[model samples]
Structure formats: C-alpha cells, structure tokens
Target: MNKIKAYGTESHKDDLKEMTIERRDVLENDVKIDILYCGVCHSDIHAAKNDWGNSKYPLVPGHEIVGKVVEVGSAVKDYKEGDIVGVGCMVDSCQECQPCENDLEQFCEKGMVGTYNGKNKHTGKQTFGGYSTTVTVREEFVLKVPTNLDTKAVAPLLCAGITTYSPLNHWNVKKGDKVGVVGLGGLGHMGIKFAHAMGAETIMITTSPDKAKDAKRLGADDVIISKNEDEMKKHKNSFDFILNTVPVKHDINPYLNLLKIDATMCMVGAIEPLEPMNGGNLIMGRKRVAGSLIGGIKETQEMLDFCGEHNITSDIEMIDMQDINTAFERVTDSDVKYRFVIDMDSLK
Candidate 1:
C-alpha cells in the first residue's frame, strides 16, 4: 500500500480538505495511474452530501478520471508506462455474471464496484476515486484515451460523456431522426451533441428561452420552449426519440406528449421518484419511456474513439484542486457554464 495525497470531506457537512489516503499496490492485472485531471460531476456533490443515502464519509468523490500510466503489472499487456488512460464510475465487477460476459459490466449481477464509495472486490477495502495524485485499477476497467483531443477537457467523457452516449448508441439513433434533448445541463448538453453528430435533427427542449442561443451553439438544430402552449402543441407527436437529462423530479407528462407513436423517451437523469404520469399519454400513442446507466468499459472506449474522431469534449472550466469546495457550491447553485475539472498537479 502507498499513502497518496488527496482532497475529501470527512463529514457530510464539512468542507473538503487535503488528506492522505492509501492505494493498494499494483496487482498482477492492475495499472497505477498518475492522475492528471479529474472532472467535477454533479453526482460528486450528491455523493459528498450523502443525498443518495448510501455515501460513505471521508469520501473522495471524483469518477471522471484522466491520467498517465506510471506503472503496469506483469500481466497487463494492453497498457504500458507513459500511456494515457482513464477510469469512470466503475472500477470492478464480478466477471462471472452474464452482464460481464456480455461486456455490460456496469450491470454486473453481483454489483459493480464504484470508483469511490464502493467496496473493493479483492481487498474488501473502500475504493478511493480520482480526486488524488494517483489510483490503481484493474486493466479491464481502465480505458484507453485518445491522444488527439484536449486531454484536460476529455475527463468529463468518462462520466457525462458516456452517460449520454450510451442511450443514443443503444437506441440506434440515426440520420433524420427528430430527437429531443430535454434540459440544458451537463448531461443534456452532451445528449444534443451526440444526437447532432449522429445525424439526427436535434432540438433543445427547455423552459428558458435564454438558453436557446447557447443550445444552438452546442449543436441543437432548433429550440422548443416547453412552457409555450402553442409551441408545445405544435411539436406534439413529432419526435422520434427524446433523451431526458433533467437531474431533479419534474412532470415528464408534457415531454411524453411530444413523442411520436412507437417512439421511446429514455431517462438518463432524475434518479428520484417523479410525479405520476397520465396513462393515457402512453396508452394512446404506444410511446414508451425507459432508463439507462453509464456504459460499460467496451462501450466507453467506443465513445472515446467517437469523441476523438469528431473532436468532441465537454465545455469545461479548469480549477485547482484546492478550489473543489467552492466548485461544489457553484455546481449546486447551477452557476457553471457546463462542467468543472480539477488539475491534480495543484495538489503537489
């Protein structure tokens, strides 16, 4: 084991502070990463505050991690020292499960180990995430990052990028499909970019008219103010697919009304319970609603490859590790333009 420098909150209500944590020695199938950048996800704030009720204290909450490989175990043939790599929301899963066999380890039947706040399958110790100087992960769970894109901006792709990319790729969204990306936050922004890049006529569905211009700049082909009665009615039953990225509970019935018969709307956000929906909305049109989690390792690599090809990366603001507490506050207040990433060198 090695004591590594990191920043984490000791209590739910306490501010994040500098601390030292232990990382296991590299195992036969493991790779040790010198973490360069880690994205600040909204879920990080949620975990830090124990909002989901499963958070463990002294939490190191970053999952969107990007860095360079400093060491590789003898059995790790796919990665080498000096190679760029990444780790997302998951670090390990039971490989015997059907999901794991199918390359969908995110749905591992035995429960996938999270990057942080999860029990390590091998050591039975709490996993520390990427808000630190280094991390050691299994080769299968580690990702090969494309060197072509902006390394700093590429960190969010591990979480926000893959979270939005999975649903679109699974649904096989294609050319000329009229796709609606609900909300304009981190997830929603990536949804728009993916839908547009996939050749769909992407529309931004939001309550704020002021966001329309910014949404267009992010690849949205058009804007629909959901609060406008005439505008909502005009586009009713016209969408081929809708990706709902609203993080909080709200009435989804209206968004339901915008889908075409036989089309589906997938929820990638708002993990909480939502208000009851009118059954008629779905029964009458045969429209469907579904949910998706982040993609598995194989698919995450694909998303990274796609991003590399298209030069896609999140709109991010860079911050020193010391400012993470303030960054958390800004994220809670919805004050950031999009996402925040920490430069781990600041900790040195």
Candidate 2:
C-alpha cells in the first residue's frame, strides 16, 4: 500500500481536510490512475455526515472519477499509460455471481464494492475514493473514456450520466415516445439530454417556473410546472415514461397521475421512504412505479461511448480541492447549476 494525500472527515461532525490514505499497490491485472477530476455527488454529503446510518468515519467521498492511466501492472492489456479512463461508484464485486456474468455487477449477489466506505475484496480493508491524487483499480472495473469530450465534465457522466441512462435504455424509451424528467438538477439534466438524443419528446417536470428556461436549454422540448394544477391536468395520461430524479422524499402521487395506461416512472434518486403513494394512481390505469441504481461496467462504458458520439456532458462548476467544504455546503442548498467537479491539480 502507498500513502497518498486526500481530503476527508475524521468524524461526522468535522469538515473535510487534508490527510493521508492508503491505496493498494498495482496487482498483475490492475491499472494505476492519476486522477484529474472528481465530480461531487449528493451522496458524498450524506455519507460524510452519516445521514444514512451506515457511514464509516474518515470518509473520502467521491466516485465519479476521470483520470489518465499513469501505470499498469504486468497483466494489464486493455489500457496503457496515457489512456483516458474512468471509475464510477463500484470498484469491485464477486464475479462468480449470476449478475456479474450477465454484465450486471451492480447487483452481484455478494454485494458490489463501492468506491469509498466499502470493504475491499482484495485485502479486506476499507476502500478510498477519488478525493485523492491517485487510485489503483482492477482492469475489469476501469473504463475507457472517449477522448473527444471535455474530461472534466465527463467525470459526472460516470455517476449522474449513467444513473439517468440505464433506466431509459431498460424501458426502451424511443423516438415518438413522450418522456418526462422530474426534477432539474444533476440527474434530471442528463435525463433530458439522453431522452432527447434517443429521439423522445422530452419534458422537464419541476415545481419552479424559473427552471423552465434552463430546462429547455438542456434538451428538454417543453416544461411542466408540477405546482400548477391546470398544467399537470392537461398532460395527464400522456407520458410514456418518466424519470424521477428528485433526491429527497416527496409525494409522487401527482406524477403518477400523469402516466398513460401501462406507462412507468422509474426512480433514480430519493433513496429514502417517500410520502404515502395512492393506490388508485396505479389501479386506475395500470401504471407502474419502479427504481434503478447505477449501471454495470459494460453499460457504463456504453453510456460513455454514447455520450462521446453525441457530445453530451454535464453542465458543471469547477472547484479546487481546497474549496471542497464550501462546495459541499453549496450542493446541499441546491445552489449549483448542475454539478461540481474538483480539479485535482490543487492537491498535486
């Protein structure tokens, strides 16, 4: 193991500060990365503050990583030094599970290892994440990123990008289908881009009238104010699919009322219990509500390739490593335009 510079909190009550963390030495099938950018995620705040009741202290919270290959172990063949690559939420998993064999390691029966605060499969040590200068990961978990896109903005694609893409791809959202993206933050913005790229009539559903202009600029064909009862009723039973990206618990009943018969709305955010849902919402039209997690390595790679082809990237605000604490506060207050990405050069 090698000690590296990183920013993390020693306890739930403390703010992030510089510290040393250990990363495993490159193994025969491993690749070492010099992290260039790491995107901030809302989960980072939750984990850092122990909001989920399952967090470990000394947490280095970042998973949307984009970097350059700086070293490779003897057995590494798919990547070389100087290759642009990425690492998302998961770093390892039990490959013998049925899900892994089917390219769905995110659902591995033994549980997939998270980028941070997860038990490492190799040494049984806690995993560290991309808030540091470097990381060494197994080749199977490393992804090849497209060089054509802005690498900084591409960082969030590893997380926010895939979270929105997986559900649409699974439900077969296509041209001529009417799609609604609930909420207009990090995940919702990407949802609009992907749905538009897929040729769907994308609509941004939000409670704020102020978000309408920005929503349309992000590829949404139209906007629906969820707070406006008249607007909500006009679009009822017209949506083919809805991607709910609200990160906090709120009532989903009204959104449910807008789905067509046999239509579905998939939740990619709001991990906690939501307001009581009305059964009549589903019973009336055979509508369905579902949920999705991040995609597997194969699907993540595919999502990146798709983004490359279409030149899609998250709208981001750049910050230095020293400003992470302030950035965290801004994120919690919903002040960022979309996402925040840390430029690792400050740490170097």
Candidate 3:
C-alpha cells in the first residue's frame, strides 16, 4: 500500500480538505495512474452531501479521471508507462455475470464497483476516487484516451461523455434523424454535441430562451423553448429520439409527446422519482421512455475513440483542488458553462 495525497470531506457537512489516503500496490494486471486532471461531476456533489442516502463518509468523490500511466503490471500488455488513460464511474465488476460477458459490465449482476464510495473486491475496503494525485486500477477497467484532444477538457468525457454517448449508440441514432436533447446542463450539453456529430438534426429543448444562442454554438441545430405552447406544438410527434438529461424531477410528459410513434426517449439523468405520467401518453403514440447508465468499459473506449476522430471534448472551466467548495455551490446553481475540471497538480 502507498499513502497518496488527496482532498476529501471527512463529514457530510464539512468542506473538502487535504488529506492522505492509502492506495493498493500495483498487482498483476493493475495500472497506476499519475492523475493529471479530474472532472467535477454533479454526482460528486450528491455523493459528498450524502443526498442519495448511499454515501460513505470521508468520501473522495471524482470519477471522471484522466492521467498518464506511470506503471503497469507484468500481465498488462495493452498499456505501459507514458500512456494517457482514463477511468470512469466504474472500476471493477464481477466478470462472470452475463452482463460482463456481454461487455456491459456497468450492469454487472453482482454490482459494478463504483470509482468512489464502492467496496474494493481485492482489499475489502472502500474505493477512493480521482480527487487525488494518483489512482491504481485494473487494466480491463482503464481506458485508452485519444492524444489529439486536450487532456484537461477530455476528463469529463469519462463520465458525462459516455453517459450521453451510450444511449445514442444503443438506440442507433442516425444521420438526419430529428433528435431532441432536454435541458442544457453538463449531460444535456454533451447529448447535443453527440447527437449533432452523429448527423442528427439536433434540437435543444429548454425553458430558457437565453440559452438558444449558446445551444446553437454547441452544435444544436435549433432551440425549442418548452414553455412556449406554440413552439412545443410545432415540434409535436416530430422527434425520432430524445435524450432527456434533466437532473431533477420534472414532468416528462411534454417531452414524451415530442416522440414519433415507435420512437424512444432515454433518460440519462434525474435518478430520483419523477412526477407521475399519464400512461395514455405512451399508449397513444407507442412511444417508449427508458433510462441508461454510463457505458461499460468497452463502449467507453469506443466513445473516446469517436471523440478523438471528431475532435470532441467538453467546454469547461478549470479550477484548483482547493476551490472545490465554491465549485460545488456553482455547480448546484448551474453557474458553470458546462463542466468543471480540476488540475490535480494544485493538490500538491
């Protein structure tokens, strides 16, 4: 084991502070990363505050990690020192499950180990995440990052990128498809970019008219102010797919109404209970509403490779590790342009 420098909150109400934590030594098939940047995700705030009721204290919460490989175990053949790699929301999973066999380890029947606040299978200890200078992960769970993109901006792609990418890929969104992205936060922003890149006529559906110009700048073909009755009616039953990225409970029926018959709307955010919907909304159009988690390891790598080919990365604001408290507040207020990335060197 090695004592590594990190920043974490000791209690739910306490602010994050510098501390030292233990990371396991590199074992066979393990890769040790010298973390360069880690993205600040809204889930980090939720976990830090124990809002989900499943958080563990002394929590180190960052899952969107990117860094250089400093060491690789003897059995690791796919990566070596100096390679840029990433680790997303998951670190490990039971490989024997059907989901794992299917390359969908995110749905591991035994439960995928989260990057933070999850139990380590090997050490029987809680897994600490990327709010630190270094991390050691299995080779299978580590991702090969594209060198073309700026590494700092690429950090959020580990989580936010993949979360939005997977659903689009799964639903097979195609060229010229009419795709609607609900909300304009981190997840929603990525959804728009991915949909547009996939050749969809991407539309940004939001209640704020002021966000329209920004949405167009981010690859949205058009913007629909959801609060405008005439505007919402104009797009009714016109969408081939919708990626709903709203992070809080809200009425989804309006968005559901936008889908064409047999079209689907996938929810990638708002893990909490939502307002009850009328079943008739679905029964009438044969529209479907589903949910997706972050992609599995294989798919995450594909998403990164896709991003690399397309020169895609998140629009972000950089912050020092010490500024996390204020960043948390800003994130809660939706004050960021899109994403926040931490320069881990500041933790030193």
Kindly report which residue pairs in candidate 2 clash with one another: none
Which residue pairs collide, candidate 1?
A: none
Off by over 4 Å in 3: none
lDDT of 1 by residue, 127-201 (tens): 988999999999999999999999999999999999999999999999989999999988988999999999999
- Give a tens-digit lDDT track for model 3, residues 1-348: 999999998888999999889999999999999999999999999999999899887899999999999999999999999999999999999989899999999999999999999998889998999999999999999999999999999999999999999999999999979999999999999999999999999999999999999999999999999999899999999999999999999999999889999999999999989999989999998999999999989999999999999999999999999999999999999999899999999997
Error of 3 at 197 (Å): 0.4
Cα lDDT computed for each candidate against the true fold: 0.94, 0.95, 0.95
lDDT tens readout by residue for model 2, 196-230:
99999999999999999999999999999999999
| TM-scores, each model vs. reference | 0.99, 0.99, 0.99
Candidate 3 TM-score versus the reference: 0.99
Misplaced by over 4 Å in model 2 are: none
